[model samples]
Target chain A: MSVTSLASQLQGLAPADGSYADLFSSVLPAVIDAIGEIASSLSTAHRVALAGTANTFGDDQLNVDVAAELVLRNTLAAKCPSVVTASSEEDPVEKPVHSEAAAVATRPEHCYTVAFDPLDGSSIIAPNWTVGTILGIWEGPTAVGQPAEKQIAAVLGVYGPRTTAVVAIRLPGSSKADAASSICLEIGLGQGQQASQNSEVLRSSVRLAAPPFKTRYFAPANLRAAAQDGRYMALVSNYIQQGYTLRYSGGLVPDVVHALVKGHGVYVSPVTAQSKAKLRQLFELFPIALIVECAGGLAIDPADGSRILDRVLQGTDERAGLVCGTAEDVEAVKKALLA
Target chain B: MSVTSLASQLQGLAPADGSYADLFSSVLPAVIDAIGEIASSLSTAHRVALAGTANTFGDDQLNVDVAAELVLRNTLAAKCPSVVTASSEEDPVEKPVHSEAAAVATRPEHCYTVAFDPLDGSSIIAPNWTVGTILGIWEGPTAVGQPAEKQIAAVLGVYGPRTTAVVAIRLPGSSKADAASSICLEIGLGQGQQASQNSEVLRSSVRLAAPPFKTRYFAPANLRAAAQDGRYMALVSNYIQQGYTLRYSGGLVPDVVHALVKGHGVYVSPVTAQSKAKLRQLFELFPIALIVECAGGLAIDPADGSRILDRVLQGTDERAGLVCGTAEDVEAVKKALLA
Candidate 1:
């Protein structure tokens, strides 16, 4: 289909089932455009060329601290309505809370919340797996003036690949104790009508050209490693031994985005009840379940197989752990919770 | 990057490693485009307007079959040096197979081969699941005047979603069986790279949406069911108590794709070696070991864990009954077979 046809099709989405899709269609292009525009201006990755060169290009945590902040700033500045930004970074900066991006708090807090990571996979900045931007589409900003604790109801992290968006959302009405979310996919194919199934189980054997792990497979060790520190070595050291590399961008949005695109997986922060600081960001677009599922993957909280959407219904925001290719892969970690 | 930049970047991939990468990259876009185009033309589709109405589609196996063939034809046509062609649908034909086309021949002694299932999931075409294409990239096309048997050599299967590309090559300059293809990605992704360690284990609880059977993970169960035909449904029913939906597409590529995308652990196609005619379509991309491992999946020839690739190298392409996916998932079936 031609780009013109795709634009029209995207416009058509507005009429499909009311204005939600329309509103989404209208804003997505601009939001993505803004993301791309200012990303380079950020001081975070001046030396970096691509996200995958983390091992060779730069440092992971510094990458996120600089890049995520820059992305959040640019995204907030581009739009007029978005207010009270949150992040997977340090904590929810309800204005004074975060010294950076203070203009966001000054703006009106209504209609739209976007959670994202400007640069993903900062850990391997030297030889990045893939650095990306993740943004979640949200309805409205969280409690702007209210104490940091009394913020909005649902939110998630969104990631961007080259120029794609992936949202991991907090199902409507999640509580502080269960900052849960659900993931669905919305691939902008520009094509109408479609179909297919999800490959829930993907047993692939791969050895890297640069070999990180010997890549062996067994149950216990694999589970334990990820649970211990997903960013330690390779978050998973199952089939491919040599202890596959582990990665965390320090910013959750970018990490999740990388998972969504590259077919990795997502992770909840794995902290205790998320602090108001934890309610840092909320996603605005990108389906929560579909994207992960489409790539033959899974996304959910690791603490309990609790329906992630339901968890979002409960109260909580700062949750963390890896979501994998299958419910089994995710649940395996949940079931093995030593904590 | 702008569209021009993105396109340029993709365009440059052809020169990165070898002409092969370039050739593959050039054809991939066209291949994906063909799949999309054929999908749009499906007789059973709802034209995107009435898609909400589920049952308004057709059930023509021919259309499904043609779609797969079209992909291979068009894709191969995009690549020039490919001197000859062979397909499970038809015998070897000239270069540049047309879209929605195939050639069937009765010739016998051909040694070179390329087998494929153009469309694998017509059975569950409506619900938007279990429909896909499998392309086998083989070496040595059927000889100018040889039979089908003489032309079947290297195998490659390009499956959709859950499906994968299993490619077995004679490797560069070496013809010996052991000198066979090195471990390349079974599923297609340049080569293996380190995966996060967090994604190491599987959940303990096994929850399937279909019938329970030990050895059968997912695939051409029609052959297996027929093997146990008299008691096939009954046997399958007994296993159903486990809670899996026969969610299989009841088609070749579709079923396998569904199983893989859903991370169903193992996908089984247990047609006895004797049922050659029934199992003539499956294809491969890279060696199964590499493919499966790359996709975070596994592939086990029904017989044993010893390298199936090794076995296929020595054996004729006539061998059948392939089981593939996660190591553990396939192991369960392997143990089930012993039992």
Candidate 2:
């Protein structure tokens, strides 16, 4: 019934001298708080009412998405002052901040860049499927097209039947090493230890459902728009013939979270000749790659068979061919593509 | 910000002398209460911990499913003593109760049969997609093989990003008429108007969204096992070539709820050669048929293009090819099948 708070989890995340620990301790709690706020607002408000009139990146903004973006921005300004630059799928371009508040944060020496999709899959909200908020932390004040390898940490807060967080912190000099050298954890949110009369309060950071992963697969047909190609369709048909059940909800967060919890499965969003890839590298794919790799799974770029975490990010809008799952599953995807 | 409660909505549902209103008033609250219990349990407990070790209908049971079934059964026994016989997807057969207690109910003259899938799409829980609890209410303790038209009311409680209830009530001699003659309302659950320490649930019976639906579609490839057949594949290929995107998550509740909320789309589960129909008529198909029909949509058997509500239920396990959505969409499905 009791869950460890995110604060404590971050406190113990790294050694006292571990820079990654200090960086996460500075950043994650604020992002987690924003997730809690979004969950509350969404649980009660009507979906259409929350559909904001503004347009962002060719999509209509949900008012809640805007609120979530502000919440994260303000929280970073206050609690994670080391975060100097930020970009979000909900915003037109990366913005600079925290120059005034840098003195308050724990690590002033390291200026971190935060790339996020404050509310991924917001359109799916009307249908009442799961959605999530994603954040990736990298070295100070990065540009829009920074590569995934520059990242130090990645965290995803998934709001579904219940709220859960998946966090991955990469230690120094370990990008090429196996999962045993990295830190990956799934955190379950429970009632805050603070006994407030407000039922909306939540407690996060209980490390539960750590992954070894079971076999499963999830990819919306839309994500597999590439499947319209005979080659890609053949790849999908291979999975179907192999008895893989489709588990996509058209939401990146829940789809990836399913792999984390279930412990096995491929989530493919391949590039199509006529259309670009759908999952953005910085905002969506990179953070998920970090979490998946740290969880003992592999996130592969099907085009080159390179690790997703090592892919070159072209821009904030840059997308890639993604195939993430257990190593064997990812290999299966690769083999099918090549075949 | 305040919304109406289910109790208040149902109170105003039918005229004072309306027998349909009285039946729903006796039944819906009890079913909704069970839904509340399941949502609470599922939101807090671990999925594997909640996995009931027992298998039912040839699948591993989630503990929440068994608990949910018991909750519904007990609620019916205690609150709706007029419910004389009951069956559930979790239970193997129909069970009788309340022969003596029927005298204590408000509608003693009626013996209602309650058949339900206490937790539909429960297997999808591990992935944290939307799942729901469904109930169908029929007259005179109807047998498993009774026709769907014998039912006077139907309700489904969807536990998704938010909790919602969709109810359809048909007054006597109104079956032949269109949706205008029926009462279809979508209720949003908030804290009880009662001063309980439980969550603040209100209900909204807004009529913002209605049918004359847009063109969209959802059917899991798994349910489209029939699609493996050359003819069915051709029909599906037609939809794909026409640019209809796949939106299925293999959960009837959320899939249907999407159609209801978005005011569009079709959800199909056709019988395959290797397997019977994936959805049960009494538990899943019939109740949804009632709700779709009441919402100005249609539910038809793909085999003969007859209305789903008019089909004779062969037994509790009897299955049918389901095609539910707007009337135009249903006709499209009929044409595709017959072609």
TM-score of only chain B in every candidate structure: 0.53, 0.86
lDDT of 2 by residue, B1-339 (tens): 335545555666656676655475667676667676676666655434323211232257766788888878877787776778899877747787565546454456767888899988766675566788888888876756676668777887777666667777776776642565677766555533221122222222312134432345556435336436555555555666666656777778888876776666777666566756667788888888888887778888776788888877778887777888767777887787766
Question: Could you give candidate 1's fraction of true interface contacts?
Answer: 0.00
Q: For candidate 1, lDDT tens digit of each residue in B186-296?
A: 222111111111111111111222334322333324333333332322333333333332322344443343343334535555443443323331343223333444344
Question: Which portions of model 1 miss their true places by more than 4 Å?
Answer: A1-73, A89-113, A116-317, A320-339, B1-68, B75-82, B88-113, B117-134, B137-168, B172-281, B284-299, B303-321, B324-336
The most accurate candidate by DockQ is: 2
RMSD after Cα superposition, model 2: 4.7
Question: What lDDT score is found at residue B205 in candidate 2?
Answer: 30
Give DockQ: model 1: 0.02
- Deviation of model 1 at B217, angstroms: 16
Interface RMSD of each: 17.5, 3.8
